[model samples]
Target: MSYEIKKQRILELIAEMVEIDVNEVKEDSDFADLGIDSLMALELAVYLERDYNIFIKEHELMNLRKVEDLLSFLKTN
Candidate 1:
């Protein structure tokens, strides 16, 4: 998939997990700052794994501070 499409899908998963609107998730938005608690983080990991086949490690999740981080990762690896 393209970068934009992957980014949008990531944001959509996050938004759906947090019950927020997709427009609310900016490229630089931090999940912790956006009120994503531990439970939500786990949900995101699972969703990404199932949807995109990206097996996210707990520490890797820490690196995913913003949507751009995810996009970069997806693009590179």
Candidate 2:
């Protein structure tokens, strides 16, 4: 799939995992700002690896405050 499509899917996944609405997700949206804590992030990481085969280090997740940042990281790695 194209990066844009994947980006949208990632957004949906994040929203679902966080128990939020998908429309609430934005490129500049910060996870913490959306009430996503480390525990939630860990869960998100597990889902990503399991469903998308995208592995992410816990430390790296610290830098993933924004949706755009995560997408950029995924695109690069």
Candidate 3:
């Protein structure tokens, strides 16, 4: 899939995992700002790896400040 399409899907997945309205999610939205704690992030990481077959380190997750950052990482790795 295209990068943009994959990015959108990642955003949608995150929205669903966090139980937030997808409309409320933005590329610039911080996970913590959206009420996503470390526990939730771990859950998200599990889902991402399971759904996309991508592995992201927990420490790296801390650096994922935005949705685009996540997309870029997933795309490159």
Candidate 4:
């Protein structure tokens, strides 16, 4: 998938998880700022891994603190 499409999907998933509007999720927005706790982050990682057919280690998931971080990871991996 294209970067923009992947980004939008990720934002939508985050917004759905946090009960917020997708438009509120900026590329630079921190996951914590979006009200994502550790469990939520893990759940998002699972979704990303399943949807994108990629595996992400726990430590790597922990490091994805911002939307951009996840996007970059998705792009490269």
Candidate 5:
């Protein structure tokens, strides 16, 4: 998939995981700052796993501070 498309999908999944309107998710929005708790992060991991087939370890999630982190990870790995 194109990087932009992948990024968009990532944002969409994140929005869903957080139960927020997709329009509310900004590219630079920090995951924790989005009001996502630990349980929500795990939920996001599961959703992203199903959506992109990316096996995101818990530690890796910590490295993900913003939506760009996710896009970069998907693009490089």
Candidate 6:
């Protein structure tokens, strides 16, 4: 899939996980600011790994502070 499509899907996934509207998920917003705690972040990682066939290490999870960070990681990996 294209980067933009994947990015939008990731945002939608995050919005669903957080019980918020997709429109509220800003690309540059911190996950914490979007009400996504560590557990939620981990859950997101798990979902991505499972559904997208990608693996994410715990250390990498720590670096995903913002939506853009996560998107960038997904883009390259």
- Candidate No. with top TM-score: 4
The TM-score between candidate 3 and the true structure equals 0.79
Better model by TM-score, 1 or 3?
Answer: 3
RMSD of each: 1.7, 1.4, 1.7, 0.9, 1.8, 1.0
Q: Residue by residue across 22-70, what tens digits does model 4's lDDT show?
A: 9999999999999999999889888977898868899998999999998
lDDT of 5 by residue, 1-77 (tens): 67788778778877877789999999888888888777877877887688678888989988788877877778876
Model 1: lDDT of residue 70: 68
Compute the lDDT of residue 41 as modeled in candidate 4: 87
For model 3, the stretches where C-alpha displacement exceeds 4 angstroms are none
Task: Give the whole-model CA lDDT for all candidates, comma-separated.
Answer: 0.79, 0.85, 0.80, 0.89, 0.80, 0.90
Q: Which ten residues in a row have the lowest lDDT in candidate 3?
A: 1-10
List, residue by residue over 1-77, the lDDT tens digit for candidate 2: 67788788889988987788999998899888888888988887887788778899978989888888888988987
Clashes of each: 0, 0, 0, 0, 0, 0
lDDT by residue for model 6 (11-50), tens: 9999998889999999898999889999998899899888
Clashing pairs in 5: none
Clashes, model 1: 0
Q: What is the TM-score of each candidate against the true structure?
A: 0.78, 0.84, 0.79, 0.93, 0.76, 0.92
Considering summed lDDT, which 10 consecutive residues are worst modelled in model 1? 65-74
Q: How accurate is candidate 3 locally (lDDT)?
A: 0.80
Pairs with steric clashes in candidate 6: none
What is the model-wide C-alpha lDDT for candidate 2?
0.85
User: Candidate 6: what lDDT?
Assistant: 0.90
- Once superposed on the true structure, which residue ranges of model 1 sit more than 4 Å away at CA? none
**Alpha-carbon deviation at 31 in model 2, angstroms:** 0.7
TM-score of 5: 0.76
Report residue 3 deviation for candidate 3 (angstroms): 2.7
